[model samples]
Target: MKHIDVKEIISSKEFIGQEITICGWVRTSRNSKSVAFVEVNDGTSLKNVQVVVEKGESDYKEPRVGMALKVTGTVVEGRNNTVEINAVPEGITVLGDAPTDYPLQKKGHTLEFLRTIPHLRGRTNTFNAVWRVRSVLAAAIHEYFQTHNYVYVNTPLITGSDCEGAGEMFQVTTIGYSNDYKNEEDYYTNDFFGRKAGLSVSGQLEGEMAATAMGKIYTFGPSFRAENSNTPKHLAEFWHVEPEVAFAELNDVIEIAEDMLKHVIRTLLDKCPDEVAFFDAHFEKGLRARLEELISHDFGRVTYTEAIELLKNSGENFVYPVEWGCDLQTEHERYLSEKVFKKAVFVTDYPKEIKSFYMKQNPDGKTVAAVDLLVPGVGEIIGGSEREADYDKLIAAMNERNMNLDLYSDYLDLRKFGTVPHGGFGLGFERLIMYTTGMANIRDVILFPRTVGSIR
Candidate 1:
């Protein structure tokens, strides 16, 4: 009687005896003298249903690809439920007209070729699955946090601070301003906040302050990394879901990260079994198995010292050469997850120099309580650590890293107040999508990946 979504139609077994109205994008079309058949996808189902369109004297041309339209037809199952529309359409309403030269055609397109058309890539099957899975994964994250009683906190983006403070910050600025210059005072005074400010690398710092007082908190939003890595894995701007929890130690944080990852994945697998099956068929052979393994098994965790020893004994020729103090590269991370562990692995107790200042200093004086979660295909999906709760220890560590303590007075104030041992991890949202879908490139997973060379 009334218009229905194509998704609803695909799910309907009750509409067999009646006519119905459906709306969706035109996937494909075939025209005949008296009849036309169309494959329509409403973004409700992975498969498009075939709609039989009989030509009328009104001269209504067949819908083109990328065009949005509404079709009213009778549902008669002569062939299958998918081919129930045997009669001529009563009417068609065009919501939007797509130009003839629309980018997404019915032809096969390579993933590399699609990067250039990122703005419209979501219309593709691969991207649709990726983005849909991505959206679900993010919701799963929020659901996990909220269920765990973690407050959703929005940290200031334009604040005069960079959490990592590694000098890889992109200075927020405005043109045509008097304070915009490389002169003596404007660098700090004339910026967007009337002081130097850049995008946050990790929300952990602010998240920490919130967790200390609020018990548990997480900030899920865009974070910027200025590292000039041009690989398919790295992006300048990406989304990160960082969770900080008070009264949680390094081991506790490690377990929390693993559990959170497994929870999101299991939720997706349960809810989107069809999409998971799509991934299992088209994306990777071990897609289902990999998801199962992550949920079924405990993540392998080895300290930095033990990992280095394992790396040396791993007998595999490493390009960067494994050392005790050096940071682990992506290759090494992959080796641990793909080869040694055969699942997600947490490499912890990284050298103090290689990690952020917040990680608790181990008694060894060489390593901090930092852990990185490495999945089978994606190198590093998460990075987190236990914070140094001792006020003197935090101040000493900050000074050792040459970080300004003044800018971090509020962060340190968490320690000044009643400080309990706390820690958390940041899950890279894009990398998680890459890990889940078996998509190789970070750019392919993100809607529009921001890389070193390409801004648009």
Candidate 2:
């Protein structure tokens, strides 16, 4: 049995009249007086290969719409299509019988319903597009780094420090529940290690070391956040693309991040035109045009001070009133990106009070050289700032924030070891995918979105 993948059939025109064996899951079935047609897919591509089944007192029964089958048939051109592999199947063997309760059916189903069955959602066209586009984006990220002489590094997922300083963390525990519970007073700890351990929030701290030594390095992996926000953007566990560069300031980091995004957008638009067309028509009405505009236009750069001033002057009703001391809300971010900038913009130099401790303090003693890259539809796709290279100031800031400086001793030593002014920002991978694919929710972009209520 010679097997040719359906995807190969896309370019292999000579196999039209040849007998070939195709093994795939049945997508849909249609029966006529003397023949039945079944559309099948083998994860080769989105388009299902059509199989013709004729009832000629043949022993092999027609396969079900969701059943797995191996069919030996001859390809022939059929009606209303080109490259038709019309098959009068000589043998049809069932590989796996699907239960009637299979969530994915021929009939159209809602994305909300598909969320309940993450195991089978990839069979749908939308998810296939989303997942494939995500893969393409990841590849583009790696390619962009390689071209720029940035070394790819994998950082550990389990750690003892919180990079963001946000009070959201999930503990990394052992399989055993052997914790000494004395009146539930002590924190849970397994006998595996004496001290408490938890999942890493961001891989930035580790990547910083690699970058310090290697000059340029990027950490791309899963980052866990126990944030309970039920918004479309928040996810419990998501992927982060953090690139740390030595001797680079906030402005350079912002430029690199912007360039990286434009690179990815252009790559996706060029590499996956069919998928882009699909998304542009359905999810993002003018996605292709928006991406083209981004690649060509210079991003708007404004200080956080300026962004706040714009918000104040816009006369827009913001639920969270914008002020220098307060953090920017999603609404405020959207207003700036969507209305004020009208394109991807960088809001830089935020108040030190609202930012992380390690951010480099400006000469004014108020704002740090932090910048967030915000796009038209999505707000705050990237957040980064220059590091405080002054040892005294770094230690003082950490102490002021009441953080355990002892844990960040290595990080402090970088400043002590004659460190230059450096900066890096984290690009949320799912969020980036949302921006590129015109996906509205972060949930749909991720394969199995770990949210507040979902671990499945």
Candidate 3:
């Protein structure tokens, strides 16, 4: 007997009256005198297949909730044109048994409680919906880039350079420290890779090198950070979707970012309507409407200087001071997107000191062409900059910050030999999923989320 999926049986009505074998875990089971009704799910879809097992039909005892089962049955039409299975006596097998202490039962579970058991949470309806949506979102990201002729490059996981220049990075080391150990700094000279290396925080630098040769390229991979923030918005390890384009400026990067966001949202709405509907009903009311508005309306665009002016005159008491050079806080970004624009907005031309050294310097030598895209609920989902293609200015920016020139010689070489006007942006993949699914915390979207004081 050929095995059939629950989704196939539920979605295809032609399978009615056909004999089939199905394998799934019991979601809920109830036994009557004549027959036993079991709701079985195979993780193929949110809906489960209803199986009717008559008395003396199976060799084993009554199946309990969470028991893995395989049964041979005949499919018949249920009420409202749905299809169900009628299990035969000789074809039922209990693949695994669930003990009485099984954590997940037939009751509602709190999200906080689910976090404790990350391994088994995926079986629940809420997490099943979340992970399915996450899978679709990931596929949509690759589709958007691939259809645009962007070569997918797998960037290195370990690197010796810091792309963001922020010192908050996790270091990779193999040397053990002890009282007898000497020359602690020099020990790295003989360690793995022959020099200091750490997990990559962003693939932008390498992605740019490939883009200069391939015209357009993207990287979808995991990046690590060592920040100690325990907020719902931060994660120690997460995925990033970074795309680089050759000969593109700030405006060009902004257009690409906007288009990509819309494409992913549209794909999610079309592909996973059931999953998206679940989030819309429970997590955030009017989520579908908000997504519809975002794709239809033009994203608001403003400069960092103008944003500071607007905030200063609005008479809103902000905890962080609104200044031209100061970095925009989460509160500021939310205000711009939620209160002022009421949609996604791009704030560009940030102060050079506040941004990375690679951003192109404006003619005034004060601000760089750095841009951040802030959405209605999440602040700053995408960040990009028109790079400093001019080799001299690039070197000067590096020098002002006292960056180690030796470590980034290869990156500097990109500007030296046949460099063009290029730009790119990094999108937080987990945060994007949060926005699409209306998931409040970044940890809830990622599987086995790594945060402060939590490794598993």
**TM-score of each model, in listed order:** 0.94, 0.93, 0.96
Q: Which candidate, 1 or 2, would have the higher TM-score against the true structure?
A: 1
lDDT of 2 by residue, 1-456 (tens): 467787776546677778778888988878877888888887766677887777776654666667988878777765556455555546677889987777776567877888888888888778878888989999999999999999999998988788877768887756445445653225444334544567889888888888889999998999998887888888988999999999998879988988898898899988888788888988889998988988898899999888888999998989888777789987888898889878888999999988988889999998888988888777788999888889999888888889987778888888767688778989999988888888888888888888887788
Output the worst ten-in-a-row residue range by lDDT, candidate 1.
78-87
Q: Point out the worst 10-residue segment of candidate 2 by lDDT.
A: 183-192
Per-residue lDDT of candidate 3, residues 1-456 (tens digit): 368889898999888888989999988988777788889999999888999887664443678888899989899988776888997556678889999888887578889999999998888888889999999999999999999999999999899999888877887877655444457556777677778788899999999999999999999999999988999989999999999999899999999999999999999999898888899998999898888888998899999999999888878999998877889999899999999989999999999999999999999889999999999888899999999999999999999999999989999999889999999999999999899889998889988999999998
Candidate order by TM-score, decreasing, is 3, 1, 2
**Which structure is stronger by lDDT: 1 or 2?**
2
The candidate maximizing TM-score is 3
Query: Which residue pairs does candidate 3 place in steric collision?
Result: none
lDDT of each: 0.82, 0.83, 0.90
Best model per lDDT: 3
| Candidate 2 clash pair list | 76-86
Please write out the lDDT profile of model 1 over residues 1-456, one tens digit for every residue.
367766666666677767778777888888888888787777766767678877767575878888887777777665553445544655667888999899886668888888888887777777778877988999999999999999999986655666876777666766445544678466556555666667777777888888877999999999888898898888999998989899999888988898888899999998777778888888798798888987898888888888889899999998999988888888899998889889888888889988888789999898888988888777788888888999999889888878877788888888877989999988888888888888878888888889998977
